[model samples]
Target chain A: MSDAYAVRDNILTHHFSDGSGCIFFDPMDNSMVAATKPVEELLNKEKSESDEQHCHIINTLLIHKMITKL
Target chain B: MCRRIYGDRFTHSIQPSEFIDFRIGIKYPNFTRRFLKPQVQFSSEGLVPFTPLPADYAFAMLEWGMNWTVAMYEFQRVIIHSAVLAKDDYAILLPAPPGSGKSTATAYLENNGWRLLSDEMALITKNTTQVTPFVRPICLKNASIDLCKQMFSHGTFSETAYKTHKGDVAHMSPQRHSIEEQSTPANIVGIVFPQYSKDILLDIYPMDKTSAMVKFSENSFNFNFLGQQSFETNVHLIENTRQFELHYSDLSEVNAFLNEEFCK
Candidate 1:
């Protein structure tokens, strides 16, 4: 089984048309998280745990319930 | 005072059977206060929602009370604490904090042929890019109060309330054109965050959608309560409009920029 992070079911994502950034809205906590295009791409698929910036983003998403580990 | 400032805006009398959305009154707090150091209170539907202010501030309090009534109770539409102005039915939202030179810019734009949607709030229909006009007097504080008076010499103004929480406060009646088209709604075309700076004549920076959404959300009055709906509505707004941050000291320069950029 693979241990990957996936966006939470209740989280709503909106991607900008210009690919500049993305916004995630979690209704459960009524919180909004804004991510750059690269970070949004990283969240959409699999993320490597070794990169410090990626790790930090994942940790924040996890804390905000925007992403869940599987 | 209302007669002088409001002009013919309230020329039509309300019918006795007509429904009134808000029943508000600005009156002296007490009998002794009326004669002594007179203070005024704002009440809506028989409930006073704010502290009494000096009698000189009665009109200002009334305007603030009206804004409070709408922001506090009106939930059908997504309200942003922004000044909205339009040119030929295309609207631009100016979402900025107090002392951000929003009102000063709005006063200039509205007088310069742009229709004023609202000076304090942008009432956008739920999940739509359409913003309805909530036209009212533009509130001018401190230095802007005097500046607007000199700039628009023909403009009607209320009595100045000195030393209020928001500094010296005054209200300028919206142009007759705006008042006449109060029932009309405009399509959202752009969002501009304005900051007045003495050093900058005019400096505009294009804002990405993500940054615009985050900043716009911070200015929403009911974003937290509306949750997903508010998020979706805001996203819809950002996607459909160009966003920018404008820092300027000159109203004429700001006016020219908006006319060339968004108005056209």
Candidate 2:
């Protein structure tokens, strides 16, 4: 339902979540911001979303293809 | 006068503790009286005031503050020593001196159900690394006495301390319900050094860890005598906690803002 975000620097970083949503705090001015899932919490959610998940998928497929060649 | 303001009152009472005497009575606003009051010999000698105030009233006030200081150490497993408050598991440690409006902030926060850790001392056992809960009467001085009376309206405040340097301070005993249910061991989530300012909005800020430690040491009750033990405890606490400096004036706004910001 509600996620807890720590107040750090100028940006809010991902901590832990309930898979429902996440929360973040602005350290510069101390404000609360929330990131919700299935809406504004996915890759389509923000421009700064990490690409690590896609890279992992591609790496797994590459490994599978190499095994087939062997 | 008793060497310092703190010396005279506790001289006869503090003899048996065997806790180290670091001579740190006034430095730390929170690491206050180490133990409670011993039975006073009113008809004997010293601080014998003939101010028409009842002996029971004066004796009880002194006993309450002193006993409160000890209740923390003896029962450190259940309370948080920090000055801050939160809505859920939220807590903040505010360490400041007398005129900083801490009482005003505390009254406001408790009204919001943040729970009172202690208005006097922040008890921490050297080994357990936890804060102890001390739910006693909240002592308010001078103008704050009147202000709090107006604010709480129905609070049971003791007769105000008369002819004292800090002014006619009064202790407001918490409701029976609060005293019974307001005890918990909170994590030291954040540290704040509050400097009250009027006309300012709510400000949630941070402080560097090392400097915060030094400030905390200065705020210790028996740190000097405890020597290495107190030093070690300070180091561990600073490492495990977030530190900050809060400068604000309005209690209602700060209270609402912290509940929203830290608890949610």
Candidate 3:
């Protein structure tokens, strides 16, 4: 559960630890290991959302151009 | 010809990149088959996961993964699966989480005349005292980004990757001088897990090899995938080095102590 807590240093830190979820934020890279199945699912969801956003932008641009041509 | 190194096996093909062994490949269920092969293939395609990165970046990722795996095979003794920083080849491995001062310490150490083995990665070969330089840039966060830039005028900062769960993050370019002259297989005399805190003190004492491996692998990028191979490599690393836990307020004193100890 995403708890509503006061921001520390203007950054909202969320802790979602159920029994099965093991999230490790390594000092190694921007990446972290989240044994939680949700983390991987979130990654995949983010990918599709980004693609959708890209498509939306292109379609909007094309529509704007067509309307301006008339 | 492309050559792939899987533990003891070195398979070669007239291709670009090779596979990372079946055992290692199986862990990342989301990974594509192209990434599954234990052989090398050629590609300039921007094939990195998620972000449509440039071909060069993808190539870098491939080279890093394969070289790391290859090194595991060649270096049978004392290869840490941890972040390493060296001052004149006397190095300390900082194995901790993001908030743990690992990259921050690296930035400080490099500024204080230390050769950076890696900003956030360590690959130990079978048997050698050479510490190779992956020499990636040191990434920092909001307060750190400003503080580091102010503390060291020689620092080169990257644009912040922007607000994430980890706050605003940026990276500092590695000292090119070190990059040019650095070597791998340096004698790992110390291993320290660094964590940032309000005051500075050495909180945890030297941990044994077995415990160190357990903690280190907990942060490994592909430990689960590499399975037994990864396990064996880490076991080798711990067997040869001493481990400790270092907690610090900031980089100033930590830099001084590490330099005094490692740089002779």
Candidate 4:
């Protein structure tokens, strides 16, 4: 687990109660990013960075300005 | 045409307390055009918003103009390019693009038993799952027009507008129950992305919330304009509703699936 990154300000995130997936709404650009359960876990800082797939997801989110370094 | 299509919705009498939503008119563009290869124009608040169509297309142009006016001016609610149908006070939002057989399915369902909230757009109040009724005629294109007429022989239909951009269009008057209950709003209980396929009998694909959200947003008419409020409202909607992608050729089977899964 790492607290090195945080969801950007004004970006709304909705996590499904059924654990299916989650959606992030970026108000700045009026864009939405849909993520799988693993990506949601990574964003919540509940998953380890050791997983290569998780690192890629974090990189993608950061590039899209959906997350920022804490 | 208005009398034939709108039925009870049309009247010469006006109540002082009633608020008119739009002041629209269909008239000949100019004096000469009215006689020579005649054409008609659609105007709202004295401003013409569309090119004049051949005189025969006057009624169709009016319908299109009304849709345009509402979509451009109605900002209090999030409007989606969808067909809204209800059963047992629960609304189902069918968001699909043209040629997806959405209007065809809507015609079938509304004539069968489902109440038609809207056939063209879904007006959803912000930050809530409730969909307000905007009951109006269901616009059917080309083949679907004849199909619907055959299926619902007792149904009222507008005169066909031949050789339009959407290819020979006509409007079907919504069931009387829909217009009678026009002021009632229904809570959304399901979202279905429907595609009509001639070969498929019925194929139901359950969509994850994330996927449903993305697809639903694409069909919205004013998603970006509403900004964060739209986002929150759509999120709330997806969270509360069951989502699916249904591909089928049979309307009866589709109706059965909807009734079994969402109507209860």
lDDT of 3 at A25: 31
Q: Which pairs of residues collide in model 1?
A: none
DockQ of each: 0.81, 0.02, 0.01, 0.69
List, in order, the clash count of every candidate structure: 0, 11, 26, 0
For model 3, the DockQ equals: 0.01
Expressed as tens digits, the lDDT of each residue in B1-264 for candidate 1 is: 888778876556898997778888888888999999999999997799998999999999999999999887888999999999998888999999988989999999998979999999999999899999998899999999999999999999999999999999999999999988899999999999999999776899999888888999999898878888888899999999999999998888888888888765
lDDT of 1 by residue, A28-65 (tens): 76798887664446565555556676667667788898
- Residue A64 C-alpha lDDT in model 4: 84
* Residue B259's lDDT in candidate 3: 61
Candidate order by TM-score, decreasing, is 1, 4, 2, 3
Best by lDDT: 4
Model 2 chain B — which ten-residue stretch has the worst lDDT? B21-30
Candidate 3 is graded, for docking, as: incorrect
lDDT (Cα, tens digit) per residue for candidate 4, span B1-264: 899989868999989999998899999989999999999999997789898999999999999999999988899999989999998688899999999999999999998889999998899999899999998899999999999999999999999999899999999998888888899999999999999989777999999888888899888888778888888888889889999999999999999999999876
Question: Candidate 3's residue-wise lDDT over B236-257, tens digit each?
Answer: 4555566666667867777776
Q: Which candidate achieves the best DockQ against the true structure?
A: 1
DockQ of 1: 0.81
